[model samples]
Target chain A: MRKRDLSQFFKDKRVILLIILILASVISISTIGIQEGLDLKGGSLLQLQLEKPVDQDTMNVVTTVLDKRLNIYGVKDVKVRASGDQIVIVEMAGVTPEEIERLIGSPGKFEARIGNESAEPALTGSDITNVDMYEITGTSWTVPFKVSPSGAQHFAEAAEGKGGEKVYMYLDGKLIDENPPTLSPELANGKGATELTVTGGANTVEEAEAQAMAVYTVLKTGTLPVKLTVIGSNTISAELGEQFLNGAIIAGLLAILVISLIIFIRYRRPILVIPIIITSVSEVLIVMGIASIIHWNIDLSAIAGLIAAVGTGVDDQIIITDEVLGKNTDNTKRRKTRTRMSVKNALFIIFASAGTLIAAMLPLAYVGFARGSSGIGTISGFAFTTIIGVLVGIFITRPAFAKFLEIFIK
Target chain B: MLEKFMESYKLLIIIPMIVVILSVGLIAFNGLNEGIELKGGSIATIKLNEPIPSPVLENQLKTALNVDEVDILNNNGNDVTLEIGTEVNPASFASALSGKGQVISYNSIGPVLSDEALGQVYWAMLFAFIFMSITVFIIFREIVPSIAIILAAASDIIIAIGGMSLFNIPLSIASVGAILMLIGYSVDTDILLTTRVLRRREGKVVDRAKEAMKTGLTMSITAIASMVVLYAVTVIFIPQASTLSNIAAVLIFGLLADILTTWFMNLGMIRWYMEWRT
Candidate 1:
């Protein structure tokens, strides 16, 4: 066998694709940045399940109210995301799960009073039938809402002879609107109106819209449309997360070193170990880059997925080395054309194996997404990362490795 | 000699089957423990500042929390993971620690959620296995060979579960995830052997099978080596991440089972199917 020069290797499409993807991954990794998952960064993640699914509008109210409540409670750096139509995932750092549970466990409370000195509330959150936010009017934004018949009656009684008095709005017993809408004379004449508006003026249209949205959120957040059950919760302390991250790094390096040793032993060629290790590492880097591009959290489960993927990547390389180079070792019987034939065959095996692995992972990923960042979060991340890893191997890295093995032939 | 090995293929095939049966029996006789993830309770990982024996920490926690049931999932030196029968808030659980250690992580699942987790695990594994079976059939397109591959994968999982039961590895989402991975990964050797023997025309069937064996054995060995190392490192450095160690352990067992199943059972079946076809 004669040595094939480097130019042909660079000219190969497979090698070129691999290099381009690796570069793209590096660029994306630098620009977009890979965000650490909650598991690694040490945060509390709560999966709140609604008793029943609600419309998107209701889901919005659920998230917005949760965000407002946490902020009002002086909780900083909180993120509330709605998953599907029913689940709400709330994540925050430096806050205990117990504190978050205590905060969101109860429904948001809204109270209306004609005066701050009054003891009893004239209206509660349940009194509001609907809050409409789609309509906006000029620099002054007005939020229209319908009140229950009973609520209209209580409001009329509370506002009777209280014209020009400011109606105070409170959410969870904290003052929301310091300068509230004043009770109109007509409404103060002891007649109840089911229709009402929380109107305010702002210097900018954006401010006006924001003001209306705030009031709407306060009112709608008054009571959840459906009961929320804390289905699952986990809290990882910051230092522990740091330790886990470090542990993962160490474990990964050791695994690679040991795997390389195995490859070297099996092939009995130190040079082959270099390419195998490079291809394997390239698979991981590409997976992480894709994860970064997609904003996937590189969590503990995901790291496991990376390992599984890299493990499979090594397996594929082994297959290629054996089929392409092993048959070549029996040089007297097999020809160059035969070696080329098995190379294609080796790739077929890679594709078939990768196909089945991805097939197996689909359901796990689906279930994880269905569970929405809860206890199954670990499993789901494992599934998703494994899928991505296998894909990168079959599509990019394996082909390059196969192409590189060509130089060993002829 | 190759012909003699072929004549005794039945015995070779029976080996993996008997292993699978015993694995089934082992799993049944020694039921795998349900992980806290499935039944709904609380598990707190504590990084103990000082070394404490398992019993001493267990007693202190039981008395401090006044909970009758407490199981230490993992206790590796200063890193200890404890599972409580019921949900305990972080405050009381922290105070129960009595300054011995700091809680690294805490996970709590109510009873209802545990039930949900179990249900999800069932469906996910079921569908994954089904999809994998379908993929294998689609790849091979032959009934007997496809069945052989599927059977090998099933046996691998059963044997792996048996290993889990024997080793006291609980059936949790994490461990179950490892089992599902076995379906995808351990089936590769079966795919290679079946494809080479049934689909390729380069050499004699025995020679093709032998060739495939070389490639397949290397694949399995490399995969197994990586898992062994991963399991070792995980157990040593980060005992708190028992999830990883559990996954690595399950994979190692499954891959070992796969070597026997794929090489003996699957290979024998494929060989018989190939001879019968002619």
Candidate 2:
């Protein structure tokens, strides 16, 4: 047979279509990019269970309060969503588990009291109108706040005869600042002072700043109505997460290389192995592109799923290649008829295998959804990515690969 | 020569059956290790400025924290993970290790959440198995081949669990995902073998079997190679990704088990059925 024309091969509609699809996927991946999960990006995930199952309104209020608190505390990229009936899943990037637990774990009730501890709180967080942090000196930082008219009047009355007496600051009913500044005689005798500064006890500017920020956040968002129990929390470091991302990419490339080597050893024909590798790679790209489009977080498990999908993709391509190339000594019919029959048989096996694979992964995805962000929920990304990969293999890449073989094998 | 081998198909099938039985026995006697993700506990990953021996760290943590169980896992030279039986104050825990390292990650799961997660894992596995079996049955529309495929899948999982038990790998969410993926992979080779031997008539029975083996073995070998690469990369370079490493490890075991079950047990069953019909 004459040498096949490479230009003509590229000119084929199927080949062009495959190239276009692959290009689209690459573009999507580069532009949209896959979202990294908290495990892949240094972050914290807290699964909070409320004390009692409340109505949707109460849950909404709780989520809103938590979101505001995290934002005020300078935690960017905070996601607070209610999962199931009583669970609230809070995910924040670039925050430590200790920081999150301290910030959100509290009911956040802030109160200031004078000498008469038996009387009601002189000023609560709800009474505060504004809070701001200021640098008093090189190393000193204080958070000042303004109270409402009623709150100011209450403070004046509480501090009238309580000059030089200490004012205690409380958070969540616990005495947080026992040495708060005493009420001065001027403030007690003069008009009710609406503004006061609370100096955070710190030896350094950075420490004071952090303390001031925490106080500001608490006073701003006030307290949550319902109590929360931290059922689960995961924190990953930024450096470690970056290492995992790099390692995953290297592993993926190495996997491709090794798989290609195996295929080459088995087939010993570059014509067949090249297409197999390209098809497998395309399947992966398409899966990732779809992930980007759907905003799926590519966590550790998802990466595993991607590898598994590609592994199975290679298996299916091998089956297709063997079927198309298997020769019979006694050919009783035309070559087309024999090839058609073999290809049909191969497709049947591929479909059957794909069906079973889909069946197996379906539960992982759906059950994870039903249970929310629990243990199994972490692996749901794996299941979903695998399903996408398998579906893409069967529907798009495998058929294109078969067509390539049908054109070139003869 | 092929006929002589066909005569002992029953005996050949018994080998894998015995392995499956032994695997089941192993699992029953030595229950699988459950990770903190499944069992409620605290895991603190600390990155040390200087390397500390795992034993020393474990002993220190146990003494300082007064915890019943403290398991220290080293992550190359970068970090070490400590698993504690009860929740402790994160600040205190960090302070206790301040002299040696810094805590990079801390995860804790309460008992209630863990129990709920464990229930979900069980349900996912059960549903996956049932659905996959149904799909296989529907595809073949034949009793013997379909049953062979399902049995092969089960044997692969059982053998994988046995391997994990022997290796002391815990049954975490990641490993469970690997097992579920194994169900898919095990069926791939079995389906290919069955289709080639039963549905096609291009060659003699033994020749067709041999041809299917060539194809199926290539598939299994390629998968095994990729998994090996993945497993090595994660273990050496990304020690923090225990999830990926565990998943790769379980897949490696399951794929190896699949080769045996598919070639010996599944091929033997089909050969016997074909011979009996003739």
lDDT of each: 0.83, 0.83
Residue-wise C-alpha lDDT for candidate 2, range B72-190, written one tens digit per residue: 76645647877898766666687778578877888888887888889888989999999999998898889999999999999999999998998889899899999999998899999
| Backbone clashes in model 2, listed as residue pairs | none
Local accuracy of candidate 1 as per-residue lDDT tens digits, A275-367: 999998889889989999989988888898899889888888888888887556455355666777778999898899899999999999999
Chain B TM-score, all predictions listed: 0.95, 0.94
TM-score (0 to 1) for chain A, all models? 0.74, 0.88
* Residue A125 in candidate 1, Cα distance off native in Å: 6.0
Per-residue lDDT value at B188 in model 2: 95
DockQ values per model? 0.56, 0.83
Residues A66-185, model 2: lDDT tens digits: 999998778878989888778899988876657767778788888878775565677788888888755456555567888888888878877777788777888888766545667777
Residue A289, candidate 1: Cα error in Å is: 0.6
Model 1 lDDT per residue over B42-72, tens place: 8888889998999998899899988888998
